[model samples]
Target: MIEILKPTELPLARETGALVAGILQTLKARSVVGTNLLDIDRQAQAMIAEAGALSCYVDYAPSFGRGPFGHYICTSVNDAVLHGLPFDYELADGDLLSLDLAVSLGGIVADSAISFVVGDSPQPESVALIDATERALRAAIAAAGPGVHIGDLSHAIGKVLNAAGYEVNTEFGGHGVGSTMHQDPHVSNIGRPGRGYRLRPGLLLALEPWVMADTAKLVTDADGWTLRSATGCRTSHSEHTIAITDDGAEIMTLPKG
Candidate 1:
């Protein structure tokens, strides 16, 4: 289902976006060395409750997942990439961590993700992987605008990841979000330009670009949710929820602080 926000509803969408971004930022700050994944989940839960917002992941029981996520945020570390179920694990220096969050406030939803090193470990590979994803996200956002094809955004993201020598994973890319967590218009990380859905004002899209160091293949963890690289190599993911406008695309999830 593709949900579009009316002009009057844009403010509420922005509010939801701010809440999601703030929580993700807060989680990143506290995810230093020795931070436990469970602790991160708890922190996310508290922040969402304090903001009077609902976590999209908590009740998210998709067929691909084990059940209703039962967690606040996705804590993907090192080899883990997507749907990372929080568990008993403390972060270590040089560990790559990705925090993906989505929340609903005033009945509007926004989603975003960020990947970074846990501590100052001088891990060049981790830094490079994160940089690639970040750049791809920016590239995709830059390509977004009214009348543009969804595949154009995907092409932009693919150009960056492929140029950076990383394989792109399309199994789980970006998607539409509004009034709910996930919606129509599957935005792949790689695609042919001028194909797929066309952009329109009031449309919200979550563009995420993630890559594994060695392979595009993924392996599911025994926990039934966490997605990891097939080769056990490091990975990174970056995402943002953007709104299509008459003139251009507006990023709704930028950190306010």
Candidate 2:
């Protein structure tokens, strides 16, 4: 469903978005060498409980994933990209880790993700992978505004990723997110500008730009959740929930501090 939140509801969205950002930031800080992915999930659960917010992932059972994810956050490590279900594996230095989070507060939902090196040691490829995704995400956001077509954002995102020498996986990009975590008007990572759905004020979207280091193909792990690079190449994902306004797009998921 394409959900356009009312102006009054936008404030609630900001609250939820900030919460998501804070939790991801906290988890990122705690993620170090030898840190277990499951431990990160536990920390997320605690924070969500403290905020009195609802985790959109814990009970989420999408068609493509195993029923009831039963996790508070997604922990994608190294080659893993999307739908990364937290497990017992410990993070190693220089490991590329991505955290995706979604939550609801005051009946509004927001989603966001961040990718970073797990420890002090950082590989050239890993740094490049994360940089590409972050740059692409910024490009997409800068192109977002009322009356702009969804394709414009896609085109903006694709330009940066392609320039950075990374291929985007369109199977999963961005989408409408408001009352629920995922909604309609699927936003692709590559498309012709001035095409697709036109943006309108009050519309909320989760704009994510993700790319694999060397290949566009993806392989699902035996866990039936984590999506890894088909060639086992490093990958990165950056995302933020934005609201369309009369003037431009307002990023609601920025960190509080």
lDDT of 2 by residue, 1-257 (tens): 78888888888988999999999998999998999999999999999999999999999999998778999999999999999999999999899999999999888999999999977899999888888888888999999999999999999999999999888788999999877888998999998999999999999999999989899999999988899999999899999999999999999999996
Index of the highest-lDDT prediction:
1
Question: What's the TM-score of each model vs. the native?
Answer: 0.99, 0.98
- lDDT, candidate 2, at 109: 90
| Clash pairs (backbone) in predicted model 2 | none
Candidate 1, residues 1-257, lDDT tens digits: the string is 98878999998888888888888888888998999999999999999999999999998999998988899999999999999999999999889999999999988999999998888884889999999999999999989998999999999999999999988877899999998888999999999999999999999999999999999999999989999999999999999999999998999999896
lDDT of each: 0.93, 0.92
lDDT of 2 at 164: 90
